[model samples]
Target: MVSLIRSALLLAAVASVALVGQASAECETIYVRREVRDLADEEWRVFVEAVQKVMKTEKPQEADGQAMTIYDDLVKQHLDYQDKCHGTPIFLPWHRAFLKTFELELQKAVPGVVAPYWHWGFDSQAPHHSEVLSHKYYGGAGQGEQSCVPDTPFKDYKPTYTADGMPKCICRQYDDNGNRIAPFSPIEELASIVENSPDFDDFSSRIEGNPHGLVHNGIGYGFSSMSSPSDPIFFAHHAFVDMLWAKFQERE
Candidate 1:
């Protein structure tokens, strides 16, 4: 009986050590990405400030010493890669990689900063009026025929490059025929897309077609074209799309 008890105790100690090792491995692999709504006001402020800093900081000196900020680099990247990244089989993964890299850049400025995602489905009923567009956030609708944004953090933002490779003020066109742009696809619609899609290609295609394209059209101007990243909301919108893809992945 004594020998049996000692064996049992030794086995228990070994099991405990193994369990601790397993937990340490799991901790090393696990990471958390938060949604836009989940972020506190302070967290959002930090993210926004980091992005603004990137926008102001110029790129490395070249032959011509181009006055390109990190923000300009991102815009140029999107403009250059839009054709390869959009409406293709690799669309979702490409954007996912872009957002991750962009988040890393943001974190370099403000440690622990994660890009926040906008849940457009939640505001599908009244996307234009959503708090995301409030003066406290991305600002209200565009003003005048050119649809130039008037009262937002980016109102004074002048990009060095656009789809046309020309300097222009950041702009948004939010209406047509005296009506607000169409609302984003609701959660129900997304649910259907996930359920009906048989593979990653089909799933991503559906997402890009509906919620993705609709949001761009709804925002108009820079957002409606390859120069979408020129608008800060572009990241938030794409992050939410990535979140939805993750949601679908969870079921698999």
Candidate 2:
């Protein structure tokens, strides 16, 4: 009877292990993120609305003894963790978490709204003409002396938690009289970035230096600043970078 009981217990343990493995395997779910310009009309509307909603919706996060909006919190997270992100080995992973957090916050505003990416590679040759800069989207380079965004859905949107902790309009200063759109990382360069790197270090540096930097610099001053999250395009740009990192991982 004792031997029989021992055999029964062993069988139960094995069964439990098998069940856990099955659950783990089934837990994998793939979410496809579409590019901004490729979103369906309804999807585009929802994405834009969700972004605007998140920027204005206040949450219970700590901020100088005042509640801050989801946008504020997201910006603060990036600004505070700048050390862990820029010019570091953790740049890719750090921004992945940042993008996911931003996505979750956006979904809270509009269920099923996915954070769209800007395929800078597609716009590498002529970024100014990319749908990403259209009036319907994030807007183009700033117009006048102040370099404030001329017009867009977010033209008047203000981010209060900027570098000076004061409200400010989004601005971009494309160098050389609006002619400096940094070509970004072309399609071929993107392919090389993912497939040619010898190790994680090389991959991280190459990505951060090119596609990422090129996009930020191309976007202009406000985006190049530490308070880049102030610009809605910042999320889309990072999303693309995050996607690139994922592709590299898959290749590995």
Top TM-score hit: 2
Model 2: clashing residue pairs?
A: none
**Please, what are the lDDT tens digits per residue for candidate 2 over residues 5-64?**
344345434423433433444535456799988888888888888988998898875645
Residue 91's lDDT within candidate 2 is 71
lDDT of 2 at 32: 74
- The list of candidate 1 runs beyond 4 A from truth reads 1-31, 62-65, 165-167
Candidate 1 TM-score to native: 0.83
How does each model score on lDDT? 0.74, 0.77
Worst 10 residues of 1 by lDDT: 1-10
Error of 1 at 133 (Å): 1.1
lDDT of 1 by residue, 1-252 (tens): 133234434543442343344343444433466766677888778878988877787888557877788888788777767776788766776677677667777877887777888888889877887888777777667677666677767766778777663237667777454237677788899888877778666787899997789998887777787877878888989998988877766556
Query: In lDDT terms, which candidate is top?
Result: 2
